[model samples]
Target: MGRPKTSASGASKRTEKDAERALNADSKSPTSNSKKRHATKETRSSKTATSPSTTSAPVVKRKRAQSEVPTADDVTSNKRSKTGRPSKDQTKSRSAKSRESEAPALPAAINEVPQDILTVFVFGTGENGELGLGPKKNEALRPVLNPFLDPSSPDAFHIVDFACGGMHTVVLSAKNQIITWGVNDNKALGRQTDWDGGLRDVDAESDDEDDTTLNPLESTPTEIPAKQFPPGTRFTQVAAGDSCSFALTDTGLVYGWGSFRDAQGNNRFGYDTDGNIIATQETPIHIRGLPKITQIVCGDNHTLALDTKGDIWAWGYNEQNQFGRHLFGRQQDSFVPSQVRVCRGNAKYIASGPYHSFAIDRQDNVWAWGANSYGQAGDPKSAGGDSAVLRAPVKIQPLCQKKVTTLAGGAHHSAAVTAGGQCFVWGRIDAGQLGVVFTPEQIQDENSIRCDDRGKPRICLRPTTVPNVEQAVDVACGTDHTLFINKSGAAYSSGFGFQGQLGLGSSDDVEVAALIKAKTVRDRCLIRTGAGGNGSIVADIAKRN
Candidate 1:
């Protein structure tokens, strides 16, 4: 919130006008992460057998601004979802209960994902920067302090993981590169910023500009330049949705880049330089046909990867069916990623919500698919009207009998965490986004929640329970809040906090789970947490001597 480089306003600073938010932003938690909430390990291509390839091709293709057509909801999802729908993939033995729940050798992601060295914390709205804090501070009701990602400064630099996008934020660098910031319009901050540039070229003192007006480079976080990739390109994971962005590569390729709107904003990315189809992807392309992926998730506009044989693929913006299949041309088949069988390949872990989708195969079964109106895709027989929407991927039956691990959601509600710590939650519940506390005879049951009309409750499809929140490990979702942490890092937050994003310093809303205590993240040893639509991001755990 500083500002005095000669009363600077380089890019004509705002006096108020900046409100227009919402383009669908953050249903992005590595599409389902905290490394799937812990226990599963094993991956580096299953201990170096190397074989699985298919890195697609593109990689850098820039040019954008095209559109080509395709939007009556993709010509009505290529005319009525191809055939009929409904299934949940049978049941009973359910593949021997998903092989008794793990250890066939495929769940490690370099030790469950978050590789430490981190150091970033933001809170509610930065106008469009979603609070990485800088463009002269747009907002932050609580957990502030992002001092250029501070690690004792001198331009320190560490990060390792981050996603939050519905406005922009993609980070992930312990040197592996890919740092983005807020709203590049639709480039989703994959790189490049300049609200106006050139105020005598202000360096003010340039440790990332603070002497004012170099215009906090879109709330500054910058990077994207390991010469743009191809030689030892590390990464590991990154996800964001609403306006697009993705990254995953410890070999299992996937690079993506902003632009997949819809619900009227109308968008698409990838395919320029005459390869046609373009509409936004300002940089970062490399999809090359898929397969060999491992895990990736982001549902605001769609994207789900998984691959390495366990298959899942899915492209973007498939109306409500969130791409469980069926499409005929309009989006040229949704931008070409394909293959979503959901079961046959036995996916091990995946999660997403903003539209819907989830996975957890290899015997621990727990699959779901796209927008089920308020059922939040947990599929209690597809909950509401028009069968709510599912179209394909089934098999959820209240998490078949638990053991879950990790799954999250928001903008309709969802949560799951099992393997001893439990957790469970379900859609909407009006607004407190289910941090638990029902019992007026459990909100009048009605086969597990649906109240409203004065009675309260309002939406939920099953999976209940959630109490005191034990060892959760991690869980996020912020179209209405959810946070949670546990296993000692302690953190909790419930729903719709006006924009304080439930960091618990106020801004209202909550129905149970509170605790975040503020003061710039209360002494921080905190493990991880992310959510973006309005704000919330916590990482901590960096200290060392």
Candidate 2:
């Protein structure tokens, strides 16, 4: 590790002297080949000048006189003659110069893809291979690219936004289109109809007579038309939960598919609409009374929608109070959209974890409700022991003061970014989903805890800042991992890395945070941290010019 000692003083002096003599000889002879030979002899002599055999006494240090210094042109010509080819150092210098000349000038503000092309983040219970493309049955190691992206087609593009359920995937396209693929059980597929002989069962036994065959319409990417929207209405966003799908239109209207249950335990479709609750539809139907909606999100068995006026509404399975309403002792469902005054002021965005929900107000304040089993509701010190399910929205005190600009939820964890560019993560740290912490206390606590049925470390209730990160613009959480995108466009991820989801090109997952570098592009780098059941995070950095 120490620096190598420099050549002995006498040897260095002699080498300098011989170099001077070679330069003078080359300059005097000009193009003479014999002059080059003399330069070579001088260079060789310089190498032996420090040999102990050639020196018996201390030599006085002498600087070469100015007149003896070779002119630039003379040195250049001599260097070319002595060496048949350019030296590695010279070649490297030339390459650097060329790169500087060819560098592309970037503008003050880089052009971003239109909102329609916004990339999506998908996470869910992959423990059953619900993520679709991953090879595992459950718990995706990381976010993976949707297999639907056709690289061979010029017009083909990756999904802009998508949602995953226990066994289904719903995606929205860059063109404001909706596509659903995966398991169709529980009428999760919005389009299911009753057709006796016309039905061809997709998953039925080939020989069972009463198998009631329904064509494999629910298992593939089926496009849903925008019929429920006002004429010419365009979709802006879409979200899917365990058994339902919610789509928001540009006109601010919200549409839903699957099942619609009311607060009185009555099935709305059974009364007003001639449809079976178990029947799936290949089409989308407008939610009973919601309009002017700005955003929509879903939880394992509930839904949340924010209207243009910033009002929040929710419905569906309220068992865990995921529906942020004060409906206690009510086994009845809210088939129609109902308002929930969780947080006052204008709502900007909403997110949902497996059994919890989160919202960001116009001021960037955060509010959360539903299951707090793993502190997914954002209370770090609460011990998540609340038996009184929050049927109404509750302000998450820790995140209430931080101007949260964005939010993402994993199966049992939640993450958010502040306007000031800091990232806060809480909830499920098992499987190292939360980025590794280097703090001595955290390390010691982790070592002391024994892995048990509680499932490794329970979710962190308090918002802990991810270590060694700054200026993080966006943060996303996978079922068991997390990802952060910085202002420089570099992506960093931590957590499970099975199946190369970390993009580290190995299956050895990281227990602590690590920088991920992609080899595909030299100037631009991509690092993915996080897992989505079976999917891996995809970080696409711009290539260097």
Candidate 3:
């Protein structure tokens, strides 16, 4: 299909001419209008002298020209007069003016909102500038005002959506621009190899030192240089895997980079040989053989893309059955995307953990498969069962009849936010990933909340309610923690806190969602969240006072 031609050029020219004419006409001095009238008379007399046969018609033309003030559009469009016909000289003048002035290619800048009250509060970890703060900082146990991305700051980075992979991060700005930071080993940052060499060198040094060495995290958000994406492509979403990245354009085309496993030859990155594993793909390549992609989710090594027709297509790592198919020990990875079997109804959303995959149907029912070692699939029958793998999609009963809106997956846990603002969690709870009380009263006296000999919450086999949180609008999951934002723009988190991913002041893990009362430049609230291995990030869409 082809795109329709636009009339924007002509419309823009009309608007510009209208503005100029208005300003010129607003002059209160009588001399300006009088000069135009005198010019009109002189022009008419010159036409009469030049053409002897039109001398008799000159008196009639002068009366009509003086009758009304000429508008810019009237002169440029060569529009017929309202009362009398225009002279040949007037028609020539209009044609010449139209040819001399052409519309601008770009539109004028529009200020959408006031910058005075716009602030972004960042919390959790910044091991590699994941917090959008400077490279000098590492951890932020509490929320801090992000000066670098502040609207009033010199950088003025305004982000709309954020995605985190194992070691890198991708963000979509309000202007449909993309900027990346954190790990760039796989060229997930989308820059050329020469530009990434310096950052990788510093990362290597940081790994060797026990002391916190500042990894050259692109401390500032850097735009994806031109030519990476096709012309006129405006990105709307992005997703990251362990060493791979994905981006979605406004037209539903998907582009991918980096290595899920080993790349072959020219398609691969870093090493040139066919035997050695490819490290990075500096540029994004379109994912062919798929329908228009609406959303993408990445596990540690696998990827799931949701299409407009409500079907799910998956590729990448399948060693642990992440792709819902059996390799029979023959292969560990899939280079081509294939549709997931056994999915029913229209798929609305998809999410992935390090080894598990999940989808929500139009009926609001949640279906899960892939690794379920800790019952992250929400299958009560698999609760503490010997086998830990579910090879095909299975509808979870606990989430049935509930209108689920969004989902997030951690390494071994799952989270869902419902229409009524209720949050449901299930799966590995040893690190408090379930965010539920493990008491028998909350489990219907079934003792379902098992524990190891060390006395820690083991796992949740069913969808357990996250107590006291309401109006939940969004949810995000890290490797072993969960974060949620309410309609009030308040953020809360639970589970592992060793690296301060939970955003609570203490290092001790919390079994329930706790409010992240971090500070910001203005009265702002958290509107979105993103989670990676041991780090979490929350975004604030500044609210007007």
Candidate 4:
């Protein structure tokens, strides 16, 4: 079924009025639901989050076969064999044999690691097994390797994109396939069944002392079938919400899975042809009725999609106007896509946080909306609001025409990159998410930057430049931390370090960006994830020496 129309004032009506009028005209025609278009948004909660770290700019990489391109039709057949992959016993036996044969322990660092050494390293709280490091090892206060993406191993696959939800992680491989692990609450990972007769558990509450064995969560990367996509279409991007997962196909079609619980307490799996909730598909289902989609991004509970026509549409949660719907007094959420009317100009980049959203227009202007409880919306004055919400998209004047290249958000912070690669961050600073320290004199300049009763900086309302990160190419955030990648492929991290999500090998929170000295072969430089996770995944490009 086609999606329902949103309120007329839903999106940025001022600039997108013409586009909305056109969409309105098309919505009246039956063909509107089937027409093709293109784009995507980028964020979420959880242990990690990632927006577009790589830009439209060219990156060195090998050519892939046309058939390998994932399509919306590739996953049409949902049928699968009862027995999936090798049994746990078989896997353990294989590992034991290999360990016994490959005896002598090598040096701590390998002198010659392959160029494609895609490593999945995680640190911090694995209490919920979000680290994917085996249940017994709940936390890695230090960066540890997953070994799943080790290029030196025969089973390794080159990971291209990664996203983290409140409790789960999803990785997209060069082969156009997806590998997901970690928390599976609400079937967010879209796994058909618990691997190995339920070694991974769903919706696990705590990392209790007695919880020692595997929790049915995939500790290792497991591929979800791509047969549901269009023929010859490969997945180009992936995203995660607090409890949902989304995939953007090369064909510009989006497929999403995971439950969307309603106020009535119904566990709705997916929308049917008519956009009504259906039983859990426990698998990826096509998100239809929108223009041809090019990009798909998610926040803690909401999603935003960008069309090639420069139009942005949002759905799901709107509790904090994260959908840019101006929803108030608990009229939150929209089951289907709705235009973000306030988003003016063709959005070249977009990002969402746990409770906020950001976009960079083709004109290099940056706009933000949703929750500003901690000045996360980039408005210093609103930091003291009774509701602390932006309600609609508003341009961050300080950054509007700075040639903003890209944007990112965390659980409670925002980031923007300029054409010159200068990175600016604002919002929650309690955890040092902004990657800056305020001297008493500087704090006095911005009234909203005063200290809390605990003497911690209340919030950074304006766009404060992150130091030592010039020429930053990409920006992403976790629940209370942020990451920046420079032109040289080096990464800098800051914020809550209790879980070591900062990649700094220590749990001490830093008031400034610090280089993550992760040991790797070549530069395992590309890092993504904009939510909370104790770990991260870095993909290696052999061609990008």
Winner on TM-score (1 vs 4): 4
- Candidate 1, residues 1-545, lDDT tens digits: the string is 00001112311332221121112222222222111111111221121222238543222211111222111111112222334542234232355456645425433343234466677778775544457565557567777768776766645456778878665678776656677776565677766664333233222234442323223555567677666666545678888886778898876788888777665556776575457887888778787778678788887778888877787878877777777767766545677877776675777788887777888888787988877766777876656443377888787776765778789877667888887777788877655778887877767778877765567566777878667767777788777668887777777888766657777776666888877887666777677788876677877767542
lDDT of 4 by residue, 19-43 (tens): 5334323111221110110011011
- The CA root-mean-square deviation of candidate 2, after full C-alpha superposition on the true structure, stands at 29.9
Q: Which scores higher on lDDT, 2 or 4?
A: 4
176: Cα error in model 1, Å? 18
Q: What are the per-residue Cα lDDT tens digits for candidate 2 across 311-426? A: 88877656566666655444244555677766544777787775678887776578887766556677544434433245556677777878887777765568888878788887
TM-score of each: 0.34, 0.60, 0.69, 0.71
lDDT of 2 at 474: 72
Winner by lDDT: 1
Q: How close is candidate 1 to the true structure, as a TM-score?
A: 0.34
Q: What is residue 281's positional error in candidate 2, in angstroms?
A: 5.0
Cα deviation of 540, candidate 1, in Å: 14
Pick by TM-score: which candidate is best? Answer: 4
Q: Rank the candidate models, highest TM-score first.
A: 4, 3, 2, 1
For model 4, the stretches where C-alpha displacement exceeds 4 angstroms are 1-119, 134-137, 195-211, 261-270, 274-276, 279-281, 327-333, 453-456, 521-531, 543-545
lDDT of 3 by residue, 324-407 (tens): 777544333365567776453388888887777888887767888887767777666665543477867789877876888787
Which residue runs does candidate 3 get wrong by more than 4 Å?
1-120, 192-217, 261-279, 327-333, 385-387, 442-447, 453-456, 521-523, 543-545
Q: Candidate 1, which ten residues in sequence have the lowest lDDT sum?
A: 1-10
Candidate 3 local lDDT, residue 143: 68
Cα error, residue 168 of model 4, in Å, equals 1.0
Q: What TM-score number comes out for model 2? A: 0.60
Model 3 Cα shift for residue 366 (angstroms): 1.4
